[model samples]
Target: MHELTTVTDSAAAQLQQVRDLVALLDDAQYVRRPPGASSVAGHVRHCVDHYAALLAGAERGTVDYDRRERGGALETDRTLALARLDVVRSRVRALAPGVLDRPVEVSGIVDARGTVARSRSTVGRELLFVAHHAVHHLALMMPVVRTLGVSVPADLGYAPATMAFLRQRDGGTPA
Candidate 1:
């Protein structure tokens, strides 16, 4: 297969995985967390928002994300969240094809001091960043989930179980 096709296939798979995981979560489990930290659903929605903007920015070649809108009530209903996840997935799917050639732009404030900074990176890169960000939050919430007495997914990981398994089967673990 061509490199672009491979890239497209991989991105599509990742996006689908995200959708699947979000679907698996219930509102109670979505919003429940440990003593301190955002709920698993909250973090997932936040990442979805970021990924949506990143994909759009990649298409437009502009950095247009406001981190101020990071964590907040994401719709108050699981149905709305699911709808929004579909929207995010649509945006990602639209950009994944063109992203191999054009890098997207991401802008954010450096500090609460009001310093703005902009950077250019591929949509693929931004997607990876968002995925990693989600993983970090998910890891933090894992313990929270346990405390809440919710059953955790058997295969949650920063590097996804499929990727991890592939790496392991290839003779070594993914670094």
Candidate 2:
């Protein structure tokens, strides 16, 4: 239960960071697209969508990443995105003790060949996957944030391993 709570809390923390970042941006900046880059809201929506799918799967025993709600108000409105974040955070915090260990089926396209695949997983495993997935998308948004002149935390999008390595290199205690 502790491990499951930790995993979910980590994801919630990342979402909070995103909410904080969104609060700092104006509506135009939130939705602004830099030349060839995705908007900050787009990146945020992508991350939130994964969490939504994962949480929904927790109730159904199956997760499908391909079927996501896209281009809704959450993709363009910072306030709406923040509201959705709160909802996701609440759901994560309320996860049942045995929920994480339950077996689950994950289905999605696996390659450019248009092949679909299904794999057995667990709620805890999928939580970890979404945590990493959020980090990946946040890292991708770093440049967009910079381009928009918005300041972000130094460790905003760093993976747990990466954060540990950085701490070690700096002669600090490993996270």
* Candidate with maximal TM-score: 2
Worst 10 contiguous positions by lDDT, candidate 1:
5-14
lDDT score, candidate 2: 0.84
Tens digit of lDDT per residue, candidate 1, span 15-96?
5555565566677777765565767677666666766676667668875667436655563566676777677666655654
Clashing pairs for predicted structure model 2, backbone only: none
Per-residue CA lDDT of candidate 2, range 2-112, in tens?
A: 778888788777777777778878899989999999998998898888998998898999999888988888887888888888898788778775898989999999999
Q: In model 1, what is the error at residue 155, expressed in angstroms?
A: 1.8
What's model 1's lDDT at 11? 49
lDDT of 1: 0.63
Residue 26 error for model 1, in Å?
3.0
Runs in model 1 deviating more than 4 A are 2-18, 67-75, 160-175
